[model samples]
Target chain A: MDEPEFIAALRSLPLHPGARNLEDDCALITIGNETLVINHEMMAEGTHFRPDADMADVAWKLVASNISDLAAKGAEPVGVLLGHSLGRDDARFLQGLKEALLAFNVPLLGGDTVTATGASTFAMTAIGRATHHPVPARRGAKLGDAVYVTGTIGRAMLGFEGAAHHRAAFDRPEPRLAEGLALAPLVSAIMDVSDGLLLDCWRMAKLNNQTFAIDPDAVPVADNARRDECMRWGDDYELLFTAAPGAAIPVAASRIGKVVAAGFAPLVLGKNAFPTADNLGYSHG
Target chain B: MDEPEFIAALRSLPLHPGARNLEDDCALITIGNETLVINHEMMAEGTHFRPDADMADVAWKLVASNISDLAAKGAEPVGVLLGHSLGRDDARFLQGLKEALLAFNVPLLGGDTVTATGASTFAMTAIGRATHHPVPARRGAKLGDAVYVTGTIGRAMLGFEGAAHHRAAFDRPEPRLAEGLALAPLVSAIMDVSDGLLLDCWRMAKLNNQTFAIDPDAVPVADNARRDECMRWGDDYELLFTAAPGAAIPVAASRIGKVVAAGFAPLVLGKNAFPTADNLGYSHG
Candidate 1:
């Protein structure tokens, strides 16, 4: 079975009240008056990170990726539990871990470690408390809502396309925590652009039963040479959200599209529906 | 750096209050009136389980080991987030995962999955709610407290030794959840005996600043012929705790020793102090 099939099987079984159908980026459960946000992300050798990548950078990326999920929901991190499989050298990983924890001001609560044979896998589960009740979800986008992206999408795409080896985008994509927190109370829907803006926008529109009329000329790209590639490329780790048209956005972002009535497709380029085969963002098979 | 050195480095960083110096079994965080217990454990191929082991059993053991930690703290599992790396056969692993989830009656929350090459590693983070306030800890044993152990020791050890191939003992050792809930209010300190009883006892004593004077004759062994070996072996997921002398004991456990004042050694056999070279538990180097 594949990953999506495995998740579908789990959904059929008994899941907790916080599971969210395994669709959202984070699980939400109310312990008392506060709602706790939790997420688990796994990074594997050879697949998620380059085999020759530095262990420290890999460690940083692992933590950053999980935290980004919380940021999408506008939750403040409480702590994290790290499940680490030791690699060839652990000192560099430790250095990177310490740096990430310090940089984020998050604590390493507890975790277990084991040695691996072939490839190493690291897992991080970040626990956060919701800053806003009814945390924003991808399905809340409404008709006529304006779509916005926090940062340039094509930087990571360019980085992946041999421009400095994606050092700025893939190696250390920042979680828009502050922007997420600031936008949580104001936006109709919010999500992180990890798997590419165009794909993620399609996801939000499909899940919300709305059509996103995006103008390729309006969508911010790092380079105009490959606008389509940059729009479909992922790993940018920016915030993609929707607000009322002309609403004052608290964060610096580009107004890329508008939420329209459901049409033949969830996404379009200036009223022309984009093909599913090419319009969607990056997805792991 | 080694495991101990790696942990020590984490201690130097800015950690959350719940981190507990990475010494306790789980991270304890009280949200409002409830205490939520969290833990993350990673199991690897070759190091944690035999390469020839069944994928279903590997999945079962992964969940069981994590829930066992919650049992030690006298907490009931709330839910779990699984960080899975695709293995040799996913169907078998899913079957085991389903059986284990049903057996424990815990919910499956959201998590991430990734593909891996070579040997695979899987991790699980268990979230539990404390049934008893002032939840038990490894450092709560007091002088003159009676040390008790649940179930039988060295069963997993003998199974690991390939003697009789203790299938039930090693494959599905009970977590003693019921006994833990019954004894949580009465116990002074408690923890799961994943390692050998002797090594774990020494750890509890050293952490609590007390000494344990254990009688080998009183310690229960799976096989009397290998009593010494059993005391040094681990993988026995049983509850080992200390309680007030003569307090209404609610669980069936054999009293193996008594807590004493600080001495030259943390643990002793009868009147002689045990050597650390062999008495310590199985530690990752």
Candidate 2:
């Protein structure tokens, strides 16, 4: 089975109410007066990075990606547990892990390590404390809410192409933690843009039973000459949110679209309609 | 690097106080009036199981192993997040996961699924709530405390060798959750016996600055003739704990040894001395 089919099969098993029916990026567990947000993500050698890629970058990206999920939930990170496979450049992996932990100020909790014979796979679980009670979700968008995105899109794509100035965007993309925390209480809906902007818009709209009507010319891109490609490339780690038209955003973001009633498509970029998510962004099979 | 060396390097990174300096099986996160116990474990092809091994058993063991760590902490499991790599017999994996969740009465949280090239690796993060204050750790065994183990050892070893009656012991070993809960308030230290009885005993003794002296005749084993092999083979998933000799155990278990002042060796079996963990049990490296 493919990724979607496997996930669908998993849905049939017993699920926690906080799983958000397997629709959210993170899981919520409320104990006593605290609600913990947990997220787990994995990065494989060939699927996520090249076999010859720097192990340091792989380690950094692993932590960043999982923390990005907590950021989308508007949570304050507590710590992280790592599931590591020992292989070449382990010292580099340790260096990257240390840098990531220091950069994020999140301590290493505990995890397991094992010796494996083939391609390496690393996994991390990020635990965080919810900063907002009604933590923002992808399915909370309301009709007429304005869509917004932080930072610029396509920077990572440029970095992947060896663009000198954009290397950090690809090597060490920062999760928009502060932005998500600030927007959580105000936005009608919110999510992180790990996938392409157009694809993420499609996902959020589909989840909320609405349509995202985006102005093609309004999205902020790293290179205006390649704006279309920028909007379709992923790994930007920006926050995508929807809020009332007159609400104070309290962050630096560009207003690029508005939430509309359910239409024939979930996303509309100018006059083009994207009825499905295929070919819009990266997806593990 | 080897598993021990890699882990030793990890100790230099930022660590949560509840990580117990990476000497314990699980991490503790205290928030408000609640303390959360978290455990992460991984299973990989070739390293953890055979290439022709049943995926159903793999999935079951994955969940059972992680839950076993929580059991050692006397925590009530809240939920688990899975990190899965797509591979053959996924339906069988789902079947086993479903059965394990139902048997454990734990719900599935959110997790990520990825496609990888070779040697499938699966990871799980188990989150639980502490049922007792001062949650037990590997470093709490006190002098004069009696060392105990739940259930007979070597069952999994026999099952792995195709013993029909012991197949379930290897494939679907049950975590001693109830027994752990019962002993939490009374035991000075507790941990699951996953990496062989001798190795685990040595670990607990070293961590507590004490020594474990065991009488070979007093230990329980599934096969009397192969007692030595039984004590050295891993994957039992039973609880190994220490408590005052007079403390009410409230559970059925065998007294295998006693904790004494720091000795020349960390473990004493009959007249044999094991100064180091080497050759005592399973070590991933």
Writing each residue's lDDT as its tens digit, candidate 2 over A189-263 gives 888998799999999999888899999899999999999899999999999999999999899999999999899
lDDT for each residue of candidate 1 in B1-285, tens digit (9 for 90 to 100): 566676776677667778788889799889999999888888888888888888888888888888999998889999999888775687888888888899988889878877888888888999999999998888789899998998888898777666676766787666778888888899999999887888899988888888899998898899999888888788888899999888878877999999989888889888779535354677742
Q: Model 2: clashing residue pairs?
A: none
> Whose TM-score is greatest here?
2
Report, for every candidate in turn, its global Cα lDDT versus the true structure: 0.84, 0.92
Candidate 2 lDDT over residue span B1-285, tens digit each: 889899999999999998988998899999887889999999999988888988999999999998999998999999999999998589999999999999999999989999988899999999999999999888788899899999999999999999999999999999999998888899999999998999999988988888999887777999999999999999999999999999888999999889988898999999999999988998764
Instruction: Spell out the clash pairs found in candidate 1.
Output: A159-A166, A199-A281
Poorest stretch of ten by lDDT in candidate 2 chain B: B276-285
Q: Give candidate 2 regions above 4 Å deviation.
A: none
What docking tier does model 2 reach? high
Off by over 4 Å in 1: A160-166, A271-279, B159-165, B275-279
